[model samples]
Target: MRTRVLAASATGALALTALAVPAAQADGGSGDIRITKVVVDGDNKVTIGTGSAKTFSVSVTATDDSGIAGADSFTLAGPGYGFESTGKPSCKKVSATTSTCTASVKTDPRTDYLSNAMAGTWYVGVWIDANDHDYVWKDKAGSFKFQRGSALTTNASPEPVKKGKTLTVTGKLSRANWETLKYGAYSGQSVQLQYLKKGAKSYTTLKTVKSNTSGNLSTTVKATADGYYRYVFAGNSTSGAITSVSDFVDVK
Candidate 1:
């Protein structure tokens, strides 16, 4: 069973009718059950969009003198407070007394109708039981980013221009708006314009442009050779990073 609770942060008890979860305790363990490490979504970034649900994984590593029996649940609490993983994770034993527990989680905003407040810092809570009747419960086991999805679009005009002529490039930066269930302009953000020769294996940064009040971008560059142009946004605290599709231009 998954438990969803609303809390400003990861602390205190979560009282649900007929199921009173104890106040999250730090390093809760009995006789050698130890939570060694916790990792979220590998790099610790969970990006979700308005179009579809996003899925990620969490791994909890623990050790006990008597070996691990299993875990009760894994709670993901953040700005909006999140999902609780109740089923046992895919368990792999590393040694006589240590095991790594991993589980996958899916997040869909449409189902919950949660607001943008869900994007921010998040924490993980864990409960692992040991083979010898020992158990461990730890809140704030690990932390990760829960960010809103972002997108970038690029367009380069004058498909074929003189070698010395000027070419214009334009694009827009937008991010998912949880409240409206749509993408909205992301203004006042710096996005890098990049270029790649027709057959070049990679792209190089040409210049950086800041999105206007309307989240629109426009820039000009001298045409030198056949190449592709695109815009890349590094993103910020609330939004995920993105790169625009490259637009190709032929130089005469």
Candidate 2:
């Protein structure tokens, strides 16, 4: 009698399992909306300077068995940096089941829309609403890095120096500070000093020096030949590379 009761319980469990499979399949097969591809600014990575407005182009492709038309809407949200979209997207049908949407968003760090956006790896999110169904995809357009802008300046004193005399060079390295909206000293970073002889088309590295607490650089070298001296900052992950204008010094 106990074995029969156990068999009955097993049979009831099978019946309930049979009913659950069809419901799961229905939910999985009901939707035809899918995001095929997403591209941001024609590349997977992008960089923009703070306080500067940069237009980012987003390209999205979607497909639906019901035929894409005016009833469907699409949007591309970016940076994954806690910003929301306040505008509608524009889309156009390309074929019976495929549609392509093009949209643009301006990244302005000074505005409310992106005031809290921080520099780092950020992603783009795509959403599609069609036939009373909503489908969302994040990071489909890949990721990008936003970095600070940097600048470098150099000056070689005593424009004309005797061949045996010492030539003094001074410069500064700075990078954009988002909080201050101005360029500030980027201290304790290594920068390369390069020299190009009068007839040489390429500049060769002379030495490397670290910026002081104030981002100031000063170095002296014996005058050799008439050449142009410049400082080059290779930049860090958070800043963009910069090269100072060449300062020409004549050696007599």
Candidate 3:
């Protein structure tokens, strides 16, 4: 009877361990240090549109054998990142051994925070200042990546996009215009589009659609808000930069 009870307890322990393994992998654990929670408050990861700027919030929690000594600070590092807050970041101390921090900043509205949302992925990290003014905090540091936006392949002439009204753009390849050079250079590759309205100070991605191998693409543009926008397409050859961009629509 004692043997059977011991066996039952062992089975229960195994079951609990099995249940925790997957979670541990997903959460990312290094030895004894573990990240318990990371909460980013926002409807969309990357918010770039035709209106006001977007705001985002980040909440972090970490746990180790000794718990967190105190979070240093947080940073939004990558292309096209902006903050409305003034001065330096303020670290929030949660407990004697643990700490938490947040990032409340306004971001561009036309972009999405996805792997393919924009040009490249952005790194958002949290750091703790153990010595108060020390630049490098090895003991308290954590980071995550957020894709800035999607690849854009657009085509526009010198025409200016009108505000309050819809602007229609049509894209087509020059006859026999596809050519290849260094990095498997060619014009038959897939393309994407991003644009901003004219007269506005900032640029926003209007739409992200595909283009045919023939280099024909089009999308309707409307500004729920007003701004000067320069349209750019993603079709540059990996080998080298081209003298002329086939996918540029200056909206003004």
Candidate 4:
């Protein structure tokens, strides 16, 4: 579906600040108006970087006996804060009484001030109205993983080393801090050292190393042939996974 970016700023921010999941979940209205499913970013994993705002799609499927009219708004709440804007739902009829509405929503770095602690599970709050004046409101309709964009970098030393000589690989793991609007170290996480031989189709994991307190990584591997070496981080719940740029080392 076609989607557009919607950022919360100024008045929009002020309005959405009151969004909350009262007692976790609730629904209202007659005629059986109900929210069936909500999909955020396809797999429900939103990864926002320090660059431009990340625009994501939200699909809300609802059913009503009198036919679905549309949705009112969509709010995302997490940790200590929340953000939302009036959803411009594009409704598609699934049946006589069911319609799926989708909208393009976004979390912008320029206006939305988010902290590191806010990266985790976030709940979606919405309201749906039907054609026959029936409506329903849900405080916590669904939830998804909200994560920070992570990055990894690598560099292998000693160019053109002997075939059996040890090559030192060094790198760092960092992620976007939405509040500070900067990339910060992601310390004490396990990262893998992978190698891809020249002319090889894929890379193979050589060994694993954990990032230091400063998110620095250093490891040694015996150079066997001309190949590329890189670092990969399998991220946790609050951060997006990433792979470092491949560094090629030529061996004699």
Question: How high is each candidate's TM-score?
Answer: 0.85, 0.62, 0.32, 0.81
lDDT of 1 by residue, 56-175 (tens): 889999999899888866877766544455355877899999999998887776665555877888788888888999987888878888889998999998888999899999999999
Candidate 2 lDDT (Cα, whole model)? 0.64
lDDT of 3 by residue, 1-252 (tens): 001111125345412221111111122223444444555454214422333345667666654444454453444433322211212344455665345556565553323221122222333455433323322222223333332222232344335445345656555332110111011113354333444434544455556545466445566765344333333444231111111233434434
Model 4: weakest 10-residue lDDT segment is 1-10
Q: How far out, in Å, is residue 218 in model 4?
A: 1.1
Query: What lDDT does the true structure give each of the candidates?
Result: 0.81, 0.64, 0.37, 0.82
- Among all windows of 10 consecutive residues in model 2, the one with the lowest summed lDDT is 18-27
Winner on TM-score between 1 and 2 is: 1
> What's the candidate order when arranged by decreasing lDDT?
4, 1, 2, 3
Deviation in Å, model 3, residue 104 alpha carbon: 1.6
TM-score of 2: 0.62
| Residue pairs clashing, model 4 | none
When sorted by TM-score, best at the front, the candidate numbers are 1, 4, 2, 3
Local accuracy of candidate 2 as per-residue lDDT tens digits, 1-252: 001111124345412221111111112223667777767677644455555767766667778876544322223223323323314567788887777777766655454223223455544455555543544343334445445678899999897999989998999998777556677888999999999999998999999989999999989888999999999998654567789999999999
Candidate 4 lDDT, tens digit per residue, 1-252? 001122356666533434433442666556678888999989888888887877898889999889998886676667645445536788999999999988887667657666677788888887788999888878778898888999999999899899999999999999998778889998999999999999999999999999998899999999999999999998777999999999999999
Best of the two (2, 4) by TM-score:
4
